[model samples]
Target: MNSLLIALVRALRSHCWLRLLGCAFILSSLGNGLTQVMVFGQLLRWNASPGTLTFAYMLATLPGFIGSVWGERLCRKMSPLRILILTEVFGMVALVFPLYGLLSHHIPALLVIQSAEALFSGMSYPALTLLFKRGLSAEELPAATAMETLIFSAQVLLGTGAGVLLFNVVSPLCILLLDALSFAASAILLLTTRKKFRVRDAQTMAADFPAHLPLHWKHYSPLQKRSILLLPALAAVGSPAMALLPALVQQIRPEETTGLALPLLFARSLGQLFGPLLLSADKLRQFSTSNRRILLCLVLFLGGYFLLSPLSAWPAVSLALIFSAHLASNVVFALGTFGVLQNFTSRQVATASALAWRGQVMVAGLATGAAGLLAESIGATGALYSISLASLTGVVILLWRYRT
Candidate 1:
């Protein structure tokens, strides 16, 4: 942990742009965490069915397909900084719908908020990723990513816990308002940083403002293509957990459905917080070269979910499983995302990032939609088990096919 902190401090101190973007990312992630809890918590309060909860998640993410295409065009024509600022601002405005939804107890308002936020998020992802690729050195990238995950998880931990506490004490409208404020805060920070970034690299900015044309898919090596798919595949498999959580809670702890949502999220975030820290240590570098280690973590990641279906009936045991599952997942996520980003060249990064994100959101959206339907038909536990088993089989085939 000390080493990780020192590394983060070093990275932030050395890079003015990173410092600004890091802060902005933190605020955005916090808002996301809080939003998850608040949205689901209110839905549970209304005695929403599993299908409804999962459908909400599906609507929130599926629009990213369009947004990614839109963002790609924007990145080709506009500055990344401008793209980010606009997306954040629009995202902030979109939250008002959710706030009204909470106030009026209207489901469509919530649905609108989900679709709008997802679109803006899709638009922002490429810009955010391109900036990181352009600004940081190769040596700095992994550390920065680790630090990013750590900060994201930590803030999410805080936000989820706070959401639970705030849910009881404050009105839902107030929670949504705070989330809007976070978006505003993040946008303002990005706006200020835009000037700093320009001053530091005016020439580079002018030369690279509108990125060059993307390389054709045929241009990428087989390994590079596989690397791009890995994260999205993992995400598709794991994405059902959040959408299914409300139902799982209501299933196992029917009397305490509202009470358990945040705790599960908190546990997952806590594991995510530690995963990067643990992996960042020097001792872990040996395993970094071994495909066997990747497979091992995959087992933990998928196996945790497989077990979660049956064990979710026990609250304490379920929390522990959630922690372990996400811990393994964080390792896979970091490795997989970095692998995709690193495979592309500077000119290709924007397109690659956009495509990668598009794949993730699209797959995850579909997976969540499937979970909703399955849950509606067979119940949440059956849905969970079915998804987990299918995911486990799919992953095995993927790894085997791609094995060197």
Candidate 2:
């Protein structure tokens, strides 16, 4: 742990630009965390049925799919720093609609605003990945990614807790305002740090001339293709379980749903924050390949889901299971997937990251929609049991195919 901490400090101290970018990311995460709690709580307050809320969430991802389709071309045309700054500017503007909706007490307006936010937010991801690929050395990439993930987890943890407390005491509108200000602050940080970013390699810049979006399946090995395709399915596995959280909370403690939900979220985020630290430990890394690590995480996720399905009557136990599943799955799934992605050339990174993210969003949307319907038909526990079974099946298939 000390060695890992030392390496992280060295990386940050050596890379001034990384420090600036990390600060921006921290601010952005704070905004996102605040908005997430506010939006979901508002949806419940507006009496959006579970099915309706899930469907709205599904619809919100549609624009993200569209954004990913064009993200590659956008990255090809603009410097990543420029793209980053521009997206932040657009996101702040997009937040205005939701703020207006909150003021007017209009549900439809809020939904529309949420969808717009998803679109612009989705567009920024590829640009951010490209920046990391361009700016960091190979040795620095893993630690940098780990650091970013850690920061995000911390922000989510702190922000969710704070958002909930503030919302309870103040108003959701205040939370929304804070979110917008955070975005503005992040943009200002980015603009101020622009000069520190490395120049794009001239040769790589020249290669961007191909007008079409640049996915060439022929270039990837079969294993790589399988990994990419399965990533979305892996992501979809947890959607049902997560989608049922509000309903589950209501069942456990009807009046305290809002009060309890954020803490549960904080638990999961806390797990995610610590999960990557395990990766940095030489003892763990030396014992397993990335694929093996991912498989183990999947098993843990499946176990958690199955356990939670039957233990819904026990909120404390269910929360513990949720935290464990979240911790393991995030490290194995998200970070492990990115580890594979790093193997690709800079030219392919944007396309691969965008496509992979789009696939996850699309599948997660479908899963959430289906989960909502299932919850309506069966109880939330039954829906969760079904999701766990499906996930177990996926894990079995993955294991057989990889045979690692």
Point to the candidate with the largest lDDT.
1
Could you tell me every candidate's TM-score relative to the true structure?
A: 0.91, 0.88
lDDT at position 317, candidate 2:
85
| Model 1 lDDT per residue over 184-252, tens place | 998898988888887544455555544354477788776677666776767667788767877877876
Off by over 4 Å in 1: 1-6, 150-155, 205-213, 281-291, 309-314
Worst 10 contiguous positions by lDDT, candidate 2? 281-290
Q: Candidate 2 lDDT, tens digit per residue, 1-404?
A: 53334555677898787788878878877877777777777877776676666665565565777777666668888777777788778777877777877889877777775577567656876777777777767666665556656555755676776776776788877887888888899898887667777454344565644666547877776555554555575666766666677765655566777666677777777777766655663333332234566667877876776675467567688779878988887765545445444556677777777776687778777777777788778866677678756765775676467542
Please report, in order, the local distance difference test score of every candidate based on alpha carbons.
Answer: 0.74, 0.68
TM-score winner: 1
Error of 1 at 267 (Å): 1.1
